[model samples]
Target: MGQMRLDTDPIVQVDRKPKCCFFFFSPKIQANRIVRAQLWVHLRPTEEATTVFLQISRLTPVTDGGRHIRIRSLKIDVNAGATSWQSIDVKQVLAVWLRQPETNWGIEINAFDAKGNDLAVTSVEAGEDGLLPFMEVKISEGPKRIRRDSGLDCDENSSESRCCRYPLTVDFEDFGWDWIIAPKRYKANYCSGECDFMHLQKYPHTHLVNKANPRGTAGPCCTPTKMSPINMLYFNGKEQIIYGKIPSMVVDRCGCS
Candidate 1:
């Protein structure tokens, strides 16, 4: 999962005095992986309580002029003399933008049927801390495949080689991984040792397979039999913070299979 604040202040068109606010965001992730995206805005307190109908639309340019294509609209009952935060689901819109970045013209918010005090749209520059309009996005990478690189730890001085787990500390800093927020270094144990016929007996299927076809099949080697995930807080390619579990990061047990 990743999140990003609004990069620029929302554009307000006031020549015709239309109750509209246009916003744009650069989503740097795959459309299929996006879990959700939201547009957060602050609705200022009104003089009296009333229902406000708001239309959220995407801008589409045409030969003559651009048109506002309505995507989804929201209706909210404004509280008298009280300010509130409004969040609009824009997951679908973000998907389109991610797939076709060139079509990102922006979105517009149109408020209708409001008297006295109209809806107040806050901008990042004008609004107070945390009240500025922004977009919150979340993405999922789905199931990650197991790493296939060499994860075995061995010693040169050791004479005996048996299936065993070794302490291996993974330091992200050594790789210049500044994106990771926590666990600069962690214990990600590796497995290393020899696997002979005696140890292969632990796994009945592997032993039988090796015994039946010794010349045709390759010999079993020491590998991780049990592994656990690690909770990681890091930034994605878009520079957004993501907190999730990375599977098969720590080897718990080693075996010949």
Candidate 2:
């Protein structure tokens, strides 16, 4: 019950325009305990001439069983494109034996360029509450069809063509529980007075002062959520509760739990 050390440094901006960067790692296991996970990635080449391609995936974002088990995938091609600093070793082989009751799991990192396109994608979490797993919606089995190609003129019906089909349904009721803590162990403050919700804006609720307070004019600000000795589980209102610091939770209109 003693072996947990994780380090992550994410600073990416892939120039040629196509970017897809995501890093999410969740570690916290002890139900049947058999965990043994190790992942190390340190690639630095801000710019020298440019050349970087990396891909690592161990499932998540709705499962991809990639041939059932024994997964240990690695692909690295950092041929000294100059700015120096390279080390990529992604390893995960067996020992993930947690039989439920303490969940949060996902590991997916995909970054590419040098003709293959796509650049930026991150997902990290192997065990011991590294936390970063939120976004799940799956319910589609039958009758979902949309394939059209009509150039008309088949005789019998030429005047009965009036098509207008617009069916858009967006429903979100997942009600929070996302974990990813490592902002230097957390310590953020910037919400002087009235803050009910406004930190990523989305409609009619704005009233914040002190942007520097010359005559008191710049609006919106709220930040103060901290608590992580590794408890991780946030979404307090629909219950999944377990908070120590997430800005002290209270700023809603549809943002920040």
Q: Write the residue-wise lDDT of candidate 1 on 137-253 in tens digits.
A: 666656655565434445456565776778889999999998785556777887777787776666778778767885857668777988988777565664334557789988866
- lDDT tens readout by residue for model 2, 1-257: 12333333333223322222233334343323433343433343333344566555443222332222224444555543322222234322223323431221334454455655433323333431322222211112244354342111112333422221111222222222132211112221122223334432432334323443568744543222322232222334322223343333221111121
Tell me the spans in candidate 1 whose CA falls farther than 4 Å from its real position: 9-28, 62-64, 122-130, 142-257
| Candidate that would win on lDDT | 1
Error of 2 at 75 (Å): 1.7
> What Cα-based lDDT does every candidate model obtain?
0.65, 0.32
RMSD of 1: 13.7
> How many collisions per candidate?
0, 26
Q: What is the lDDT of candidate 1?
A: 0.65
Assess every candidate by TM-score: 0.49, 0.20
Q: Which ten residues in a row have the lowest lDDT in candidate 1?
A: 12-21
Q: Pick the candidate with the highest TM-score.
A: 1
